[model samples]
Target: MQNPTAATLYSQKQIPIGLKNTIDKTLSEYLKDEKLASYNIDNLKQIIEDSKINFNIKTIKWDEDGSEKSTSAEVASILGMILTFIIYMFIIMYGGMVMQGVMEEKTNRIIEVMISSVKPFDLMMGKIIGIGFVGLTQVFLWGILTTVLVSGSLFFFGGNTSPEDMVAAQMAAQGVNNVAAGSSDISIQVQEIINSINFGMIGTSFVLYFIGGYLLYAALFAAIGSALEQQEDAQQFMTPIMLLMAFSLYAGIYSMNNPDGPLAFWCSMIPFTSPIVMMVRLPFDIPVWELALSFALLFATALLIIWFSAKIYRVGILMYGKKPSIKEMIKWVKYK
Candidate 1:
């Protein structure tokens, strides 16, 4: 009776639900015979009991050696997704803040006073980097806190646990011996996933791509904010940016089933989508050359975009009340 939400359409759990629906509908249509309909509840119960139509499905992911993998691909995908979501939120939230701050200064005519002394490019970079530090500091603190908590918990569990308790825990992890046992299994699985992750690689790449991705998007956002007289005036420009963000996210998700597939390979190469899509591939242990190439491309693209965005900011920030078309913004980028 569980009705999956729209987001659940992406989940693999729907396979069993689809199977059940097929069987139920087929049974219902064929059970319309008057003789069958006349069967008593007891008769139906006896028929079902005697039918012996039972299914017990167990899934195990095998490694190259034919041994069961310690962690499921689905669980690994979830970890990759969580990393991507954090980066996405950081970019959007901090990048939007940069845009809003620029808009506030322009609308109040404060930038006019400030810009006479500060270069437009300097002002834009200052705002972008200043806000970026705040996000970086917050995430750094969260990392410290999480590491301490996990380490403390591990110390207690590993050092003080009794032999009997550890045995019991292993049993619970292997089977649903009791409610407490089942919970133990979940915890063990989580620990296994954590142990298997390449935090050094993921953490380093995350900081690099997070900063690079934010810089790239924030530049355009700042340019749009400077060009518009009112927030409503920016919607036309915002639509394309929003669509691009959504497509990047969806591309990353679809590539999870095949991290090395053509889609994943290409998406991770593109600077616009690579930040999100590359995170999805990190857990799968992609090659060193590929990772290096992706990293170089992202920062290179970011730097190039920031240069053009600063040009647009220089021209648009001074203009008042005129709604700049995308074509006009392009012309600003071409200025000497």
Candidate 2:
């Protein structure tokens, strides 16, 4: 029965419907046989009874046009959260690669030759841009490949036909009306959720935030890489940056239940965490002003950071042996 054949399925005038499910039986037996510190039959019975009790409940929501709402925002929130995590990882992973690439070139004395002809700012930017394209290409390939694979699999396995529907179909073909209610409601709800998404807005915002976030962090990583004499010294500078990104990630997750909360609002506006946090709020349709301001701050901060980091890159790219301190980097920014 675990892997029923076509003949077995066709032979059935009646299809079984979960009365003697072996998996549930096995799980129940395991729970009953298990020993636990918190095991109490009386308490367990009370919990089971409580779970069976149902209260009369009704939910009413209206759309912008005053029509009653049936779509679930929970799905949108989950999708937004997933996108936020991807942005977080994309920035950190590619930004770290930028730093490592700079460290490698400088360590091998290749920077000296490259710098003889090219300005430090141009060289630094070229490296960042090159690595950024590579990251973009990788993501594009993954998106294409995943969509193809999923579509192919769905086609191969009978697209959109649930097992219950298949069984019911077979029975119906044999002149039997034993088919119970199919999960067509679930499918309709899924379709509604898909239709509810504003892809134009979300897609454009995702790309904008993605680019701005990467540029801001990659510039910081480039400066840190240029300033460090040894790769082992990265921790002293990277600790705070890592903590900031981590906090942004956590803020995004926490915002799922309350996207309009004060924490989410501030994090979305602050350039340091906006890229990650704003993603979680995008699906919720946050105000236009909030979105515009967050985007503005992100790009503005990225440009300013690039200008200052370029100054450090100029000085540190040439100096060798001595490790530059925070004070030295600050002074490097002021160098003519």
Clashes of each: 0, 0
Poorest stretch of ten by lDDT in candidate 2:
1-10
76: Cα error in model 1, Å:
1.1
lDDT of candidate 2 over 21-126, digit per residue (tens):
5545665555554532146465675576578966744333467899654456676788779889899999999999999999988899999999999999999999
Q: List where candidate 1 sits over 4 angstroms from the true fold.
A: 1-69, 156-192
lDDT, residue 269, candidate 2: 95
What are the runs in model 2 whose C-alpha is more than 4 Å off?
A: 1-51, 54-63, 67-69, 145-181
Tell me how far the alpha carbon of residue 191 in candidate 2 is from the true structure, in angstroms, after superposition.
0.2
Steric clash pairs (candidate 2)? none
